[model samples]
Target: MNRWLVPALALALIAASAASLLAGTVWLRPQDVLAAIAHPSDDLPGLIVLQIRLPRVLLAMMIGGILGLSGAVLQGLLRNPLAEPGLLGVSAGASLGAVIAIYYGFSASFSLASPLFGLAGGFVTASVAFLLARGGGTLALILAGSAVTAIAAAGTEVALNLAPNPYAAYEIMNWLMGSLADRGWDHVRLAAPFIVAGGALLLATGPALDVLALGETQAESLGVAVGRMRLIALIGTALGVGAATAVAGAIGFVGLVAPHVVRPLVHHQPGRLLLPSALTGALIVVLADTATRVMRLGGPPINLGVLISLVGAPFFLWLVLHVRTRTA
Candidate 1:
């Protein structure tokens, strides 16, 4: 990790956030944005900036950062460069919980209930996934995660099929597509504490991860319990990613992409890669969302989730090809 990367990432996050705040439908100057944040007023621009755009912007950044941190931790846990929370089915598990909340109408009663169920779903599935493939390597974990994701997806679809009202199902479907548009401070408040705390938990495992990189036997000899470390990583990933999916739906590939982009910059040190990956993830999402708004200027609005998938899905294939070539 270069001494300067964290500060640089911080700067980039700030720049991206600023760009997002200014890029919306209502034009607000930099000064206007500053005044809107620093001063309270009863004007439309002020209301738009403070109430509508700010929460969306913050949530995008936070969700991206959470995904990034989770990705890095999972990669470190599995000791596989290609490992990611979504690819490992953690995000899908969380989304399953959110779907259940929506189906059962728990979300109708309390705004926070959905996220809590999401957190629990992710936690349980992650634990179960690892336990199901205990003593198996990265490939086993990947296979287990694929199975978990498929089951969750099927369950969600079944619920949607059985939804009592067409309108309710339609709303749930739209929410699943993911967008920061029209989000409020309530969303930000809902996800921030869990994200920050969960990210911290993941990052805290850096030393254990570094040790485990030496191989499980070596780490165990050094008093690092491999099982415990893996559990911690899963819990951290579940908390952060579950909260994010709860609030923003499943925004894919931020995790898979962020750490890879930051690894070389950080000299491939897993411990050092955490913060930069998180910051870069924040940057990726802020910009993706900004692009979404820009494209919407001339066409039907595109969802942020769809935009990231279009871009990331290709990148994922390229990565898979590259990895295969190297391994072969």
Candidate 2:
């Protein structure tokens, strides 16, 4: 890894965060932003910067960082270049949970209902996957996760189908599309602890991940508890990605794309890839959210998750072609 790579990523994240604060429906100059931040007044600029954009930026950083870190860890753990947090069904479960909250009118009466349900759904589905895959290896875990994801997705679709009104269905679909728009400090408070804890857990597995790259038998021979490590990774991913989906709807692709973007910079070392991937993920999501604010497509800004998918789907195709060419 280059000595400067981490620092460079950090600098980029800082710049992205700044851009997130400044870019919105009503753009504010740097001077205005600084003034708002420093004074914390009741003025429109202050309210916009302090109350609206700041929390959204913070949530973007946390969610993106956790997704990236977890993606790197999952890739390393499974020895699969394409592995990501959602492979474990956490995101789907969370989405299902939130959808249920909305479908049942719980979210209408309680502001925290959706997120809380999302967290529970994520945890339960992840636990089911883990248990079903126990005593089996990586392949089993992947299969179990896929099954769970399918089930949860089906449940979500059923909720939509059974919705009493078109308005309810539209609301569910819009939430599923995902966005950081209108997010506030409450969301930050809700997701921050889980993201932080999950990130720490993922980061702690770095050395083990590097060892596991040599193969599971060799990793075990080196005194790495492969099963325990797998458990930790799964739990970390569920906590972080679950909370993110809970609050932000079903944002995707950050986990899938971040690690791949940073892998080369880190010389393809799993251990070193973690932090840089996290920073890059934060930068990507923050920039994407900022773009969502600025790029009004006639009627309204694009959903954050939708924009990421639009970019990521093409990148994913390119990756497939590149990999095929290399292996051919």
Candidate 3:
């Protein structure tokens, strides 16, 4: 099954990427896409395909992969099926930073300021959550995360509340709604390095996580540094999700859904679920963003975050019901 499933997911990613390039407001042909990539120029088709949509598509894929992987890593570390970066306060922390930047008009002055500050905020919140969760069991971690999430969320609301004017307030509010509109290569360049570093750290934790699944006492018996391993995962999730949220503004649920989708395919091993979860996440965001561009027949373009929330809320409800039924 690995032979077929991995390749199939790869093909799906590739196909979805191709479809993203071809299906847009202008609807470029296959050759048009190739040409735009080869020679980006001032022409309408070249400028539209190369300058606008391509970067947005790549951004969606990258952000999706990062969020998906971060969610999988956190779930593994915490041993909680409902765990995700958002629920852990990482995404909310990042959103708070970006919102603060916008509130002060710092985002307009500096291209990289929002994301960098977002990273700082995520680390701070995750650090606090870690400190609170230390020495406690799984329940402690979740409760601590919940507490931090509420705090960070309240902070974000404060930032929004203090917006200088209604327009500024609308911008701040809309940023939380999350759109990929008009994103360029600059956003990609700014976000790519942090995601790469964070993803590397996350990828390294898989073995330790697998050991961790056996319980802390058993993990220590197997020579795993349980404390250090959790630290790495905590930091990695903060970094990756912060960077993604900095650019994408709190696109939700990709990570939570992606891991659940791939877990059964990987036979329920958390370690093996990581890479496939990333792939599934890339597929989801690309397709969702694509629909946003093409399916705006008469209405305004759909925000990517809105699309995910529309699907995710229902899916999450169903998952909760299913899990409760099984436990009952």
Candidate 4:
């Protein structure tokens, strides 16, 4: 696959996201959107088009892009088609952190603190799982991740139950559902740097990931720094996922499914798949977010996470059965 194609696809998704932002609520024509973007004070439509929708659309691009890239990384590293950021309990851990922050009212003190804590939680979980899986390779990592996920999820539930205020549960519930509504530049600003940094790290490790495909002993024999490469990839995942989960609040399936969706486009070449997966992830999230805004359920906005899980959970179960049968 031509590398240029990935960027082109990402750009197209971004354009679509932008269009979706303006189209659904008010049905702004493309020319009017362009005009509104160009000149800020034409009318209420112009203002709403530029101010309200554009930022959200851009945020969707960033979150989706990050999830896609990280998903590709996780899949490549674990050598499992089923691997996702959530698979290793990183997303759950981040959610736990965010939940704690929200429950304790830290979010009010510092809006950015929620995500920072979430990022920290993601990193700790991924690192721990990575370490547990380190010596034994893929199987060990999967087991450790599973264990961690169970533990973290239990912890999150406990925190939710123990919340001081009853309304805290509602707030936590909303956050967990992963909406892009009411998010502003503060979120973008908080998440962008970490995502960019993490993305850079992942991109830099592409050559190493290619080597890793050859098996650990083979990779090490070929002058690949397996340990360091794993560390770098883990850090990249932490930053990328942490930032994304911080802002998006555990939007599932993008990491798990995006790589699978794009793998064929890259001919199953790990390195080639990375960018395309990223683009596909971006497309999925942006499209889902757009749908969330436009698609109403009984008069309120629907939850994006529920929508994804409804679709993904069945696929995930089928995947599990398929993997087991094949292994058997």
- Please tell me which predicted candidate would have the highest lDDT against the true structure: 2
Cα lDDT of model 3 by residue, 1-328, tens digit: 8657778988999999988988876888899888878987788888888788888888988888988888898888878877787866888888888888888988889866777777788878888988999987656767887899899899989887877889878878778888788788988887888888888999898888888788788989999887787778777777788788888888988888889877867877888888888888889999998988887757777788999889888987887787578669
* Cα distance off (Å), candidate 1, residue 115: 3.6
Q: Estimate each model's TM-score.
A: 0.88, 0.97, 0.92, 0.87
Off by more than 4 A, model 3? 109-113, 131-141, 318-328
Q: Return the TM-score for candidate 2, rounded to 2 decimals.
A: 0.97
C-alpha RMSD of candidate 4: 3.3
| Candidate 1 lDDT tens digits, 127-214 | 7788876887656777888898888888878878998899669767866787777678988887888888888889898888778778
- lDDT string, candidate 2, 140-205, tens digits: 999999999999999999999999899989989989999888778988999999999989999999
Question: TM-score ranking from best to worst?
Answer: 2, 3, 1, 4
lDDT of 4: 0.80
Q: Which of 1 and 3 is ahead in TM-score? A: 3
State how far residue 192 of model 4 sits from its true place (Å): 0.3
Q: Which stretches of model 2 miss by more than 4 angstroms?
A: 320-328
Rank ordering of all candidates by lDDT, starting from the highest = 2, 3, 1, 4
Q: Which candidate tops TM-score?
A: 2
Higher-ranked by lDDT: 1 or 4 = 1
Q: How many clashes in each structure?
A: 0, 0, 0, 0
